[model samples]
Target: MAKQYTKNLIKREFLKLLEEENFNNITIAMLAERCEISRNTFYYHYEDIYMLVREILRDELEKVDEEFNETFSWEESLLHAVSFLLKNKKAAQNLFRSIDKKEIDSYLYKICESVMSRYVDNECQSKTIDAKEYDKRLVTDFYRAALVGLLDKWIQDGMKESPDKVIFRIGKLFDGNIERSLRISENLDEA
Candidate 1:
């Protein structure tokens, strides 16, 4: 309870500073000052700034996972996930441009892979596809790569496009073709 509150406060301050300066430029003292907490309190909650960033990324992924679980459609799930980025554009941008970008990319890959896996599982359950686990994983990897690629571009381009517009374009590209594409790949592999 209190611990969670402290962590959240620290995360909030960290993100606030990320907007004004690069993650590398942010220090424990800066965070403590912004949050009005002692430097020891900041260290009490997080081992270091990297730990805070990782926790925030993991927390955001868990949030989207929960939302995805409640969703009836993949589109809804994806939009829910993207809403986090939309809401935290400044923080997101700073993280992307930070020296810790590799960490951010790894986290983003995990979230994308999870989302793709969920989408594949839901589709399989609906009898939309009868794919083997391997095929499903292959498809998941493909979509995850594409999704992450698009996200990298979006972040690099300053996220100028709206999430809805980007999502709609993605849906148009693959909304109903995942199963068909997997089948096509299987057929090509058998040849």
Candidate 2:
């Protein structure tokens, strides 16, 4: 219990610091000082700042996944995920600016892929598409990449636009697109 508490304390302080300064500017010593723990304690919980950030991203993904399962709406799930970054705008922007682009891109890809996969599955089931596994995968991948690109741009632009409006536009644009893609893939396979 105490161990978990210490870890959470470190995470909180780290995020607070991220909001104020760039991730590269933060150090283990600074985090330790803020948490009022020894340097070893920070090391005990995380190997380095990178690992800490990775864990936070993974946790956020898990929360988004859980919420996605409950709501079964891809738009809502996406909005929920983006809302985290929106809520922590400064921290998110700082982290994005300081961290390796690959790290953030990889995390965003995972989130987009997961949400898109679920959406494709639900759409296939509802539309009675009977899409082949390959077709479904292709459709999911296409949408996932598009979604990831959209999110990457939004973050790069400092998240100026409202997430609700962005998601609503995405929903409007994607309506029936999945079904069309599936049918087209099926037709290609038949041809």
After superposition, candidate 1 runs with Cα above 4 Å error: 69-72, 182-191
Quality of model 2 by C-alpha lDDT: 0.84
Q: In model 2, where do residues sit more than 4 Å from their true spots?
A: 70-72, 183-191
Model 2 poorest ten-residue lDDT run: 182-191
lDDT by residue (tens digit), candidate 1, 1-191:
98899888888878778878877788899889889899999888888988888888889888878777734555567667777788879888887787466876787687788788998887776755556777888888888888888777888899888766776777877667886765565445432
In model 2, what are the clashing residue pairs, if there are any?
Answer: none
Question: Per-residue alpha-carbon lDDT of model 2 for 115-178, expressed as tens digits?
Answer: 8888888777877877888888888898788889989998899888877787778788768777
Clashing pairs in 1: none
Question: Evaluated with lDDT, which candidate comes out highest?
Answer: 2
Error of 1 at 74 (Å): 3.2
Candidate 1 matches the true fold with a TM-score of 0.88
Query: In angstroms, how far off is 28's CA in candidate 2?
Result: 1.2
